[model samples]
Target chain A: MRWEGRAWVFGDNVDTDQIIPGRYLRRVSYDELGRYAMTGADPEFPEKVREGDILVAGRNFGCGSSREQAVMALQQAGIACVVAESFARIFYRNALNRGLPTVEAREDPTEIVEDGERVVVDLDELVLRSESGEVPLREPPEFARRAWREGGLLELARRNPERPPWR
Target chain B: MATVVERFLSEKCGERVEAGDVAVVEPDVIMLHDGSGATALRTLRELGTERVKRPDRVVLIFDHSVPPSSVEAANRQNELLAFARRHGIERVHVDEGVCHQILVERGYARPGRVIFGGDSHTPTAGGVAALGFGFGGTDMAFTLLYGELWLRVPRTIRVHVTGDLGPGVTAKDLALTIVGELGAGYADYAVLEYTGLPERLPVGDRMCLCNLATEAGAKSAYVPPAEGPERLRPGDADETVELDASEVEPVVSVPDAVDRVRPVGDVQGEEITRVFVGSCTNGRYRDIRAFTEALDALGGPDPNVRIVVVPASRRVLLRLARDGTLERLIELGASVAPPGCGPCLGEHLGVLGDDDVCVSTANRNFPGRMGSVEADIYLASPLTAAVAAARGELADPREELPRTALERVSGS
Candidate 1:
C-alpha cells in the first residue's frame, strides 16, 4: 500500500480538542466533524486540506480523548495518513480501526520532510520518501495493512459478518 | 517482566507477552455511554449486524446526557434504548452517574479482568487491579460483536509513592503533581502501577489516581491488588520511578490543561465563578461525604459561587441521599445534578459561560471541555475545590482544616 501526498505539519501533543473540540462533539456526525476539523487549532485548516493530503507532526499526536471522532474528522477531512514521532495509543488504534494509516517515525519526520513537500508512504516497505531522503519506519502487522487497504474496520466487518472480525 | 497488561495478554494468548506486542483478547465487559453508545450502535448498522455475540457482556448507560440536554440529545438517548432493546442488552444503566463507576459499583470490574469502555477515563476501574481501559468507535463496535479487540502490550511504569499525604492533600493532588513534574502524557501508552501505597489510602483516593491516568497519557493505571482488592495478583513491572510524596500539598491543575499544575497558594486569589465537586474521577460516596464535611466546616460555599455536585452512579447518589450527604450539598447552595456525567462533558448542566473560571473535580480541562471556549477550568481535589468554593477563589484546602480533618477524611 502506497500513499503520496503533500505534507501538513502539526506540533506535538495535538489533542482531540485541537483536532475537533468537545463542543463540536454534539454534532456526532462524521461529516460535520470534517468541516470543523483542526479549526480548534487553525480555523482555516479544513478549507486548506485537499484529498490525499498527509499530516506530519511531532510526538503524541492525538493525545487526548478517546472521542474517535478526532480520527474520523481527519479521515473525512481527506487526511491520507499521519506520520509522527509517536502517537498516543488510543489514537493510533482508532486510526487503524478507521482505516486511516498512521506511521510512527522513530526520528523526527518533520526534520526530514518539510511542510508542503510531496512525500510517499510505502506501507508495504515501511518507507517514507521525500526530497530529503527515504526514512525507514516500522511496518504494521499484516492484518493492519489489510484493514487500511480494505478501507477500514467497518468495511472489513461488513465483508465478514458471520462471526465478525475473523482472526 | 510481565505487567498486569502483559500478564493478562500472555494468559489470553497462552504465550509470553511483553510490552509492545500486539495481541487480541476478549474483554469481560464493554461499557458504552450516551456519547459512544449511539455511535457504537451506528457502527453496528454500518456493519450490517444488529446482534452482538455476547449481549450479556455488553453494558450501556445514559451518563453523558442523563435527563437529556436537548430534544436531539433526548432523541439520541431514546435511540440508544431502542438499540439496547433490539440487541437484548439487559445490563443497562440509564440512570447511572458514569460508566466507569457503575461498572465497579455493580461488581463488573473483577480483579485481573480486562474491561473496555467508550470513555478515556475507563482506567478508573484499574483502581481495583483490573486491566480496565478504553478505545474508540470501530474498536468498540468490533469488540461488542466479536468480544475481542487488539492492544499493544505497554511496558509497566511503576510510580512508587511514599510519605503520608499532607493535610488536605489528596490522590487527585498527587496525580496532578505527577503530571506537572513529569509533563502531561509522560506515561503515554504505558501502565502506571502505584506502589509504596500508604496503608491508609482509601478506595476513593485510589480511584481518583487511576481515573486521571488518562490525563497522564497512560493506557491505564492500577493500584496492585495487594492494596486490598481481592482475587488478583500483582504483576511485575519493567521500569520504576520513586516519588517522594511527603512534601506534597494541596495543588490545582490550572486552566486549559490537566498537566499544568501548580501549588494552590500560587493562584490563591484567582477569581472563581464556579466550583464542581463531582465526576467519575471524584464522585464516589466517600468523596461526597468528605467534601460535604468540608463544606459544613466552611458554613457553606460563597454565595456568589455555583457548586455542582454529580454523583458517580445512582447507587452512590442513593447512599448519599439516605445518609443526608446530598442534603448537605444542597444546603451548601450546591445544585445537585442527577447521577450522570453532568457538566463534565460540557453539553449541559452547569456549563461555564464566557470568561467563567471554574474549579472542578472533572478530568479534562482542554479548551471548551466544560462549556464555552473562552471559559477556564481548574482541576482540583474535592477538598481543594470545596475550600476554593467556600472562599470564592483558589485556596489551599489545608489553609483552615485541622490535621484531624485530613485523618478523618482519609479513613480506611
Candidate 2:
C-alpha cells in the first residue's frame, strides 16, 4: 500500500491515557471513540485531524491498556498509519491484526518531516520521503512482518492450522 | 529462568509457554460484569460443553452496568442467573460489589497461585500472591470446555527498591514512576519481580506493586514472598527448582529513576475533577484506612472533587461499613460504589468527562484508561490520592500522614 499524509508529531512515552483517555470506554461505539482520540494530550486532536494523517511518535507509543478501543479510535479518526520509534507489544500486535499499517520510523523522521509537511509512506520499500530526504522506517522484525503479511499469526493458524510454518 | 509460577502452569497445562502469550486459566472463579455474563453464558451453551470440569472453580460477578442501568443489562443479569443455576457454579457475586475488589476481600485469591478472568486487569490478583491476567471471551469459553489452558513461560525482571520513598510517593507512585521510566513496552515479555523493599513496605503495598505489572508492558509483576520481623507469613525459600530469587538483583533494561521523583510540576494542578480510591491495586481495608486517615488529616476533601470509593469485594465493603470508614468517606463526599469495577474499566458508574482530570490510586494512566476518551487520569499512592482529594490536586501524602498513620502504613 502506498500512501502520503502529513505527520502529527508526539514525543516520548505517549501513553494510552493520552491516546483514548479511560473515561470514554463505556461509549463502546467506534465513532464516539474517534471523536475523543488524543483529547488528553491535545484537546483539539479530533477536530484538527484529517483523513490519511499519520501519527509520528517517539518510544512506547500505545503503552497501557490492552483494550482494542484505542486502535479503533485511531482507525476511525482516519489515521492513515502510525510511525513510531517503538511500540508496546500488545498495541503493535493489535494494530497489525486489525489491518492498520504501522512502521518504526528509523533515524528521527522528526528532522526530515514536520507537522503538516507533505510526506509519502511507501509500505513496499518501508521508506518515508519528504522535502528533506528519504528515510527508511524500520521494517518489523522478520516474524512480525510475516505475521503482518499473513494477517496475524492467529488468523493464519485458523486459516491453515495444519501447515503451521512457525511450528 | 522460568519462574515457579511459569514452571507450574507449563508442567500442569501442556502449552508451549512464552511470557507474553495470554493464557486461559480454569478460573477457580469466573466473575462477570453486567450484561457480559450473559454473553459468557450464551457462549457456553453454543460450545455445548457438558459438566464443567470444575464447577466450583467459577464465579459470576455482576458489578458492571449494575443496578441494571438499562433494561438490556437487567435482561443480561437474568440470563446470568439462569446459566449459574444450570451449571451449578454458585458463588455468584451480584450487584453487591466490583469483581476484583470482592475476589480479594473474600479470599478467592490467596498467596502463591494463579487466577484468570475475562478482564485484562485480572493481574490484580497479584495483590494476594497469585498470577492474574486478562483473557479473550473465546479463551474463557475454552477454559470451560477444558479445565486447562496454555502459556509461554516469561523471563523475570527483578526490581529492587532501596532506601525509603522520599515522601508523598505511594505504591501507585512507584508503579507509575517505574512504568514512566520503562516506557511501557520496554520489557514486553518479562515478569517484573519487585524485591529488596521488605523493610520499606507492607504486604498491601507489595500487592499494589504486583497488581500494576501489566501497565509496565510485563505479563505480570511479583514480589518474592515477604520476609521480616512482622512475619506476615512464614519462612520461605529463596530458591526452588523452578526459579531462584536471591541470586538476582533488581534489574530492568529501563531505569526507574536515579531516585524517586516528586509530582510532574511544582503546582498541585487544580481541584481534582475526580478521585478514585479503589481497585485490585489498593482497594483493601489497609488502603481504606490509609485513605481515611489522609482525608481526616485534611479535614475531609474539597467540595468540588467527586470521590468514588469502590471496594474490591463485598467483604471489604462490609468491613469498611462496620468500621464507619464508609460512612466517613460518604460524609466527606465519597460515593461508595458497588463492589466491583467502578472507574477502573470506565464501564459502569464514575466515568470521567472530557473536561475532568482525575487523581487515582489504580494502575496505569494511559489514555482512555479510566472511562472517558478525553479525561486525564493521574496515578498516585492512596495517601497521595487522599491528600489530593482533600487538597484539590496532587500533593504528596507523606507530609500530611500523622507519624502514627505513617507507621501503620509502613507496617513497621
- Model number with the top TM-score: 1
Best candidate (score: lDDT): 1
Best by DockQ: 1
B1-412, model 1: which lDDT tens digit per residue? 4567777778777788788887777788888888787778778888887768788999887888778777666787899888888879899888766888888888888677788888788888877777787888777888888888877788888888877676677788887887787677689878888877622367677778888878888888888755453334455777787888777778888877788889999998998889887888888888888888887887788878888888888888899999988887777788988988888877778888987999988888877778777888999888888887888888776776666667775422
Fraction of real interface contacts that model 2 preserves: 0.31
Q: List the candidates' TM-scores in order.
A: 0.92, 0.74
TM-score for predicted model 1 compared with the true structure: 0.92
Model 2 agreement with the true structure over A1-167: per-residue lDDT tens digits: 56788788887667666777655544344347799888867889999899989888877677665555567688888897888877765567556545566788876666677877778888779898888788788866676667666645445544543333244
Q: Chain A alone, TM-score for each of the models?
A: 0.91, 0.82
